[model samples]
Target: MILLQANQVARHFGGETLFQHINLEIKDKSRIALIGRNGAGKSTLLKMLAGEEEPDEGTITRTKNLSFGYLAQHTGLTSQKTVWEEVVSVFESVHAIESQMRELEKLISLESEKGNHADSNNYLEQYAALQQTFLDSNGYGIESEIKSVLHGFRFFESFYDQPVNTLSGGQKTRLALAKLLLEKPDLLILDEPTNHLDIDTLNWLEDYLQGYRGAILIVSHDRYFLDKIVTEVYELSRHQIYHYTGNYSRYLELKAAQQEQEWKAYDKQQAEIAKLEDFIARNLVRASTTKRAQSRRKKLEKMTRLDKPAGDEKSAKFLFQAERQSGRDVLAIEQAAIGYDDTVLSEPVTLHLRKQEAVALIGPNGIGKSTLLKSVTGQIPFLKGAAKLGQNVDIGYYDQEQANLTSRNTVLEELWQEHPTFPEKDIRTVLGAFLFSGEDVKKTIPLLSGGEKARVALAKLSMQKDNLLLLDEPTNHLDLDSKEVLEEALIDYDGTLLFVSHDRYFINRIATSVLELSENGSKLYHGDYDYYLEKKKEEQEVAEMTASKTEAEIPAASSAKRDFQQDKEHQRQKRSLEREIAALEEQLTNIDTHIAELQKQMEQPENLEDHEALTELNNQLTAQMEEQDAVMAEWEEKSLLYEDTY
Candidate 1:
């Protein structure tokens, strides 16, 4: 059931090689992830797989009529239509059927009013057929489907009529994903689909994608999301792709073990090689032992040497340090309201931060998580009660937007300006720790990529040595490795932390407590992200229980109704459709068996020598595959009917 396969896929730039000799296969319903450090050509490889970009040297094969949907990273949908129209566009065929059903309904009503029973019956037949088509195409449930997906993306019905062009960047990105999900392509290729998604929406998407019927190929830095959805991991490293079994966590475990074994084997081989070389060198000069030395030399020449194991040599590295330890009370926020001009997004926020406490601020988008952080730093004035810093507390902020980093200065100057007293080499040393070295430091700030700018901002922040850190989406543009590195640093920081992040893994690793912001106010969960989730789950269960009790006490609606003869006939039609689907499936299986047999025969030595026989076998294989495709289409239609029937 391989939906797509690529052989010897390779891509190259102007005069440099990005990756080569790559091979990949995507099976039906496969949940696959491609992960690597930034600049490792992961996005390029994804584009090639989606058929949006051709590989420089490779052949990609896909099943006939394969449908594919690709969501490039950070690319939002540029639509002039309203949100409702944009999403409904995915159901054009269903809409056509719906129109026909409406026309048939009108004709039947007109005939019945004119006292023409026979004409009405004729119209009724057409209506029934059109209705079946509409149901099979999911026209009846289209609105519900769109609403469900939009809800998962945190879009309510009130926003349905709004123009897509007016939506924020994050909202547009979510809308693009929702549209793709509704389309339900055979292969869904997502590049950083978790971007801009809060924890609640992320959880919803993870649940949806887990039950997705199609294959998925994703390039994301969300380790927690990947662990929940993907079953296979592909690592692109040092110009090659390696496949590993299981989820992201399992892949890490397996990869670490595999790398360790490779190193041990490599070391063992080197020792053996050194021993052999020494023996040959020492004994070759001795006439009495010349034959033995020559034998050893011959053996050494025949032995295959193992290539050195590739490592992550370019992973960003840095550390966070506090200049001075703060008092026991690091920060205090009481009855604080934060928002833009004349708009109160959240109110009555109250919190107490102790020294060396890491707190994560989480909420749905537009709830002022980032604005709250800004208010704390005095960048944006609080609408109500202001935050009060503890005795001798100093603050450093990491803006997710990198607003303070808009400069024409070189990367070196960006950091060096903050501490003019430090020597040039000393400034470069700190930059080098963050993988900005040599010519990289001379590059202008505007030319740096999102990831590069993030590192530079961090480099500057780390040097400030503030005891209180306020970060907003610190893992926004980081690759998986860099995010882990930052997480490790923040986890070990001696100062107190209050950051806003959508990265669940990052929050779990760093946050000692969770502060959940809402439109009404803020509530503190005195535990890590996981503990917060557990409490939320318990609350949801209680709410559901209360709802169930209320529902039970209310009067029951009348029992459902269906026309007796019509219902019996519908059941019969459903059974017939199931039988047809089963038959088509069996036919496809038989065709596949024949195709396999033909391929095996073509590989036989006698068939290979006989060109005529080989050609015949190849022709037969192609014919069988064509037949399978036709049968598969029929089976799909029948299955759809079975699922959609009344």
Candidate 2:
């Protein structure tokens, strides 16, 4: 069923059309994503659909009894109540139903005691009807439903008693989302819901939304989340809405095909019009052909002209080129502890980064990823141990907050002042490449939008010519197109890179390895994001198997000692075989680590120049890997045999 529909919807501001003649429908349980570049008025359109804003020229129609809820991009709950109280307030109707049921029970009992049979029957009938209504609405499970949503959002029991106003901005946003889910509106509209969510919470929310009963309209730049949750995409571009019937990746494919077709049709029509115009110009002067030319002119006047298809907006183009190569060991940290003041966030972390390697640092929020970066860059001193950069290494840092940008400085001044020796025209040329042409460069830092600030930072980084880069959430506030541009630039970079990001797609695109930081220590996976997930899953499965094995173990009684002893011998043999398998696995891991190190070394300029040394190292790595594989097969066979014997 269609819950709501928009007919010929158009929104205008300051006599300029943001979008016009837009028509869409929100159906029951539909999953739709509203996607566009930044400042394209996606939020404005969402507000119109949610009835918070009226369209200048259109009608928005909602079905009877249809309920809609909108979670704006920046929503904060202000309340004197505690977190739990604020969340449970969504079930006011359910509580009211309970109160009415109790009142009716008391009334029915009093009427019965007074021997008023007719009145007592009437009260009981009202009570029965109310009870049915309550049951149909799932009123009895209100608290459980609230708990389920809160838990999915990572709001544990400790957070329940906290005052709503005392919570962090991200916590408040999450609480607001949880309340919306509990409200169970017929149409739910969310703007940038993934902004403050960590990976685990993002995953859980995706699962929850998949099972949700109501329709969802979401606007988010998180490609990975959109790909997982949305089935249909509505792209708002150039003052128009275009629909695509798939996820974000599929939308790209179809949008490209569509643009190609549009351009082809447009070119064909323009050619035909040009040919007719030429013929009319040449023939119209002659008396004999004047009548025919007039007829053709009338035909031309009756023809419809196709508008030229617009191409994509301009995007930033830059590369990260190092002035000189660093040593093979670009960075080294030994027994490092990172945090503020006396608080140690992570246990001693030891890492060795090689030249030309791109590492993605990921963990839960407040888990010290950024703190560690600061310690390495000397913004904050390390709590313990040492961090050292290799010979000839130069550091370039990109802070997510753009703290280096002064509010008083103009865009041109920001880049020019960074390197005063460069000519003003040269700086302006670079700014133009970043799409800050004309008066755009004159805008001060404070007046610039978040995306504009990000571009300024990238322009500064590009001019630094640093060999080593340490970035903290560089993609924050960047539009999808800008993010892609940065990704391409980083992928083509010749320098060593270490970045902290929550964007899984970005990690998948640019990371040569993943360094997963935790409270315990960091684990390095020698592949992309997908490989990290696979390895994590395998580790979890092993842990579960070990736990199940321990839980299943039982002790034998005194009477069965003799039989137990006989079985114990078999167990002893099994334990010995397990020890051998463990040893083989450890050896295999060592070989794998060595192979990764060798590969990293092979990419160095010096090693590449010496072909003989590179070939020798490669051959050694190949032999060790072959031996490791053989040992792994033998271990697997022994493990299977041991399981069968047990």
Candidate 3:
């Protein structure tokens, strides 16, 4: 059954048509992903569907008694109400029925006490009817269900009584989602619902949507979230809606295939037309073949030519130029303790970054990922040690808050300001490439939506030629398509990348290394997010296995025997550590010999004049020294640990 049908829906802002001749039909229990570029009228279409806005042309018809609950990107929650009270408000009608039932019960009891049997009987009957209505509405389990949904979204017990306004934006979004789930409308329309949610909350939402009895239409940039939830995809482009029968990943594959097929058909048709034209041209000049020429001409005139497949071929292509390469030590931090003011949140730590590597810094909110980014960029002071940048390192920073853009400037002005050397036409072209075109470029930065502002920030970043790119939540307000474009651009970017993003799919695609920040401090994983997840899972399984192992399985006669073996192992570790130290010393001796040889060659009267050779030798020596120091430091730490254990 079709729940809603949009016929020839057209929307226009001023003289510009956002979308026209758009036709779409949503069926019962359908899960659709409403996808388009930033300004592609997806939100407008949603509003039209929900009857919040009317289309300039066409009609949106809904089945009778079908209800829709729309969770806008920005939730509107009152400040005075507690979280629990806010969620319970969704069931106010049921509560009202219960209150009526209670009043009827009281009236019946009072009438019976006053010896009014007839009135008492009537009140008792009304009370029974209200009781049935309450039961039918599932009023009994409403509170438990609300609590369960809230818990699924990671709402703590302490937050239940907290005022709604006290929660963060993400918390409020979650609260709104909880209320929507409780309401159990016939259709749910969510715009960037997962924008402010954590991984755990997103996962819970995926589960919730999967089991939802109604249809859902969600617009989100989280590809993983979309893949896990959406059953169908509706792509809005060129004033038309294209429906795909599967999730985001499937949509991508099928769309590529469809484009390929269209291209093939186009090529074949063009070839056929060329052949006909050639035959007609060759036969036209032959005197005896005038009739044949006329017949071919007539066939050509009657031929229906195929229309070429048109799209923005250059929209997906992104390129950046970099100057001289940075030094081998792209970045380094020694004994860096970073925090606000005098409070140190983490211990002194050391880190090193090299060229052509992508690193992702991940942690829970408020655990200092952004602070760490600030420290690395030298925007904030490191309380303990220093953060060192190598020579010729040009940093392209994309801040999470999009602080780079001026509020007063329009999108076009912002782009032009960043690349002042570019002509007006060139700036417009680039802005259009990032999905900002026409009047969209005229919208002031402050007036643009969060997603639009994010796109503008990214477009500005793309214009710079830098050897190092530092991004914070680069995919925050982008759609899945835009995220893919950004991913492709970053993959092709010939630079060192270090970013902090909560988007798992983005991290898995772009990150070559993972740096996890936890209560125990940061730990480095030399793999992408998925690999890190696998490694963590493996460790968890091993720990569980170890915990489940029987003590009897150990070859120990008693606890004393186990203790004695542990002591022996500690002594063994100390001896092994000493051996390892000796080996590192020998390795360092070999490195010193190589450096001395290179130094002596460079010091030669004839070789001293060769700048290239000298530079190469110096770089090699620096790398060797850094490596040796690192190995020696590790050996010293291990030795201390061994001694402590003994």
Candidate 4:
């Protein structure tokens, strides 16, 4: 059944059409992801669906008495109310019925025997109906369930009694989510719900949403979150909607295949058109075939030509020109204790960031990740120990706060001021790459959004390349599509990257090493995010097994004990080897898949016709295949180790 439908929805602002002729149907239990570039009317469309905003030209139809919840980027819960009270308010109707039922029960119990006979039936009927309604609504357990949902979202015991207004923005968002969960709407629309969440909360949300009974429409920049929760993607672009029936990963694959097919069809059609044109040009003057030529010309004129497949021509390309390579020690910190004034968060630590290495700093909120970053950057002095930057290291910083942008300057003015020698067109192109097109370029920095401001900051950084790039949450406020563009640019970049991000997909793609910050300080791991996760999981399994073995020990026969010890060692070694093999095989499979995709791109006639791109694709494929072979060798070695242990 269709839960909501928008027919010919047209929304306009200040005589400018945000979207027109927009038709959409959201069905019962449909998990849709509303995706678009920033400011492409995704939020507006969602509002229209939610009936909070009326369309200028069409009708939105929803099921009668249907409950739908919209969690905006910002929620409007009053600050005076406690978190528990705010959540409990969702069951106001059920609570009211319960109160009425309790009052009737009290009156019936206290009635006289003579009056009780006549009043008993009436009171019993009302009591029975209310009790049934309450049970059906799960009224008895509503409070417990609300508490559970709030706790799952990391709302601590101390936070439950705190006034909503006193909470930070992130805490308020969490409280709003808890309230929405308790409401149990038939349809849930969330906008960037994961922005304020820590990794643990994000994981908890994933588990919660996985089993959610209602339909969900989420707009998030977190690729991993979207992949985990959404079953379908609705991309709002160019004033139209494109549907992809799968998770983000599958959507990427299908989108690539579709683009490839479109390109092929386009090439075929162009070839036929060329052949027709050539015939007309060669035979138009011939007296014997003049009529045939005229007919051919008419057919050519009437033919509907295929438009070329659109590409992200304006996507930022990082053509970094580093001044010079840094020394072997890019950065070193010893006995480092980092944090703000009167709050030394991290314990004493020692770490090293080597030259030409990309490192990602990851941790939960309030874990001193950003503090450590600031200390390394020399923006904040470490409470203890020393931080040293290598000789002649030029650093470019991209902070989420976009502190470099001047509110009074226009985009052009900012770029021109930064790079006086750069040409106007080049500056405009760069700005366009960051989605500041036409009059948007003329807009003042003060008027720009958080995302746009961040892009501007990135654009400024791209103008002057450096050997070291220290980015703090560079992917924050960016859409998934924009994130992909950034990923590509970063992949092609030559500078060393030291950045902080919660985006696992971005970290997995770009980081050559991981720096995990915890209460114990920072620990460096020599692998990407996925590798780190695998290692952690293996460690946990080993710990669990050791605990179990210790609990089940038999302290009797020495020979039996020795044999048991030997068996346990052998089993541990076997499991370790098996895990190693599994990890290697997973890497090999991924490399093979990437190589196959590159090969497909290389085989495209359009790409092949472009000699430069074809050559690049061929080189990439060869490199990926070599990597795959290395991984396979490692896989075989681990397999052999497992066999020997067994």
Instruction: List candidate 3 segments past 4 Å from native.
Output: 100-136, 285-287, 320-354, 381-395, 408-456, 459-467, 539-646
TM-score, one value per model: 0.82, 0.81, 0.78, 0.80
416: Cα error in model 2, Å: 1.7
Q: Which is the better candidate, 1 or 2, if ranked by TM-score?
A: 1
> Compared with the true structure, what per-residue lDDT tens digits does model 2 show for residues 1-646?
9998888888888988989888888899889999888888889989988889999998999999988889998797889999899988887887898899999999999999999999999999999999998998788888788888888888889989999999899889988998988888988999989888877788889898998899999998888888998899998888888899999999999999999999999999889889889889999999999988888888889989989999888778977899765654679998788788888888778788867789999888777998888889899898888789875689999998899999899999999887899998999999987889999999999999888999999999999999999999988888888889999999999889999988889999999899888888777887899899998999999778666654335232334455767788888998988898788767765765676687778889999999899999889877875776577678667766776665
Report lDDT (Cα) of residue 137, candidate 2. 79
* Pairs that collide, model 1: none
- How many clashes in each candidate? 0, 0, 0, 1
- Higher-lDDT candidate of 2 and 3: 2
How much lDDT does candidate 1 score? 0.89
Clashes of 4: 1
Report how far off residue 236 is in candidate 1 (Å): 1.5
lDDT per residue (tens digit) for residues 1-646 in model 3: 9999999999987999889988888888999898987778888889999899999999999999999999887775656899988888889999999999888888988999999999999988888888889999998988788888989877878888999999887788778888888999999999888876666567678888899999998887788888889889988887778889999999999999998898899999889788878888898888998778788788878988878987553353445556545544578877677778877766555667766679998866666777888888889888778878875688988898999789999888998876788999999888888777788889998898777888888888878878988898988877666678888889888788889888989999998889877545677777898899898899899789767767875444345466767778878877887888678767755765675676678678766788888888889878876785686577556645665664
Better of 1 and 4 by TM-score: 1
Give residue 292's lDDT in candidate 2 (0 to 100).
Answer: 88
Measured on C-alpha atoms, candidate 4 has an lDDT of 0.81
Candidate 1 worst ten-residue window by lDDT? 552-561
Stretches off by above 4 angstroms in model 4 are 13-15, 111-125, 281-287, 294-304, 348-350, 413-442, 543-646
lDDT, each prediction? 0.89, 0.87, 0.81, 0.81
Best by lDDT: 1
**lDDT of candidate 1 over 15-82, digit per residue (tens):** 99899999999999999999998999999999888888999998889999999999998888889999
lDDT of 1 at 443: 96
